[model samples]
Target: MSGNTKIDVSYVAELARLELAPEEKVKLQEDMEEILGYIELLEKLDVKDIVPTAHAAPLRNIWREDKAGTPPGKDIMLENAPGLIDDELIKVPQVLPGEGMS
Candidate 1:
């Protein structure tokens, strides 16, 4: 890893929308260099014939029996509701436009 191979800390800060202090910039630069070195080491590994496995152990379906079941009636379902205006509506927190919820 050459010292001349610059890691643009300012560009990183801008992308993350972070306001890094001058001292923090120096620390982050060192950390980024170390991370790049580790990635470079990983790039040199040989795994030509290795098949990718999703889990460490052998996996099984472990699924439950799928069958149709009766659902509770509307009155029983709505019994625990704090604020139900009618049979059709359930009152909830007042949501505002442009608040990221919509």
Candidate 2:
């Protein structure tokens, strides 16, 4: 498969809201072509009847029951907190509205 058939870097840059210089565009085009060539080579490999495996080593389901365990009281939970006001609220730097990134 041709690189042109696989990817259009200029179109991708436009979607990403990025501006690339002429040299950068050329470099990216070559890199994309090499990547597509590797993918085409992989497509030619035979893997019929192979059982899909998520990991190489012996695998087991690593999970615990979802039933609730012992719960910490509110006072115990907030005992080591850096900033707390009363039993329910955490004090943080007040951020002024409309003063941050869009």
Candidate 3:
């Protein structure tokens, strides 16, 4: 990928269903060229010994078996809340009380 070679910015934008302004098109062209140049540089690096991995970090399933159990209802959750009215909704304490401030 020669940096001197022109990247088809308009063609790429058309394929991606984009309507880039004149300034935007110029910026995108420059950006794409830089990106391609970086890729070319990476191609020159020695990666024969490096194993192919989906992620840079080791992926592990830190999960447990899903056990079938009865989940608590909304009513049960409201009962544990600080303020519980006759209505099903949980009433929370006011963030600021008028009595406290001058």
Native-vs-model 3 lDDT?
0.80
lDDT pick, better of 2 and 3: 2
Clashing pairs in 2: none
RMSD values, in order shown: 8.3, 7.9, 14.5
Error of 1 at 6 (Å): 3.0
Worst 10 residues of 2 by lDDT: 93-102
Clashing pairs in 1: none
lDDT of 3 by residue, 1-102 (tens): 455767799998899999999999999888988888877886677888988888888878787788888889888777778776675867766668666432
Over 4 Å off, model 3: 1-6, 60-102
Task: Go through the candidates in order and give the clash count of each.
Answer: 0, 0, 0
- In order, the Cα lDDT scores of the candidates are 0.81, 0.81, 0.80
* Residue 25 of model 1, lDDT score: 94
Distance (Å) between predicted and true CA of 68, model 3? 9.5
1-102: candidate 2 lDDT, tens digit per residue: 544476778989999999999899889988988888888876666788989898999978788878987888888988888888776787776677775542
- lDDT (tens digit, per residue) of candidate 1 on 1-102: 444567899898999999999999999999998888666765566878989999989989887889888898888988888887766568787677565541
Superposed by TM-score, candidate 3 places the C-alpha of residue 27 at a distance from the truth, in angstroms, of: 2.2
Which regions of candidate 1 deviate over 4 angstroms?
1-5, 46-102
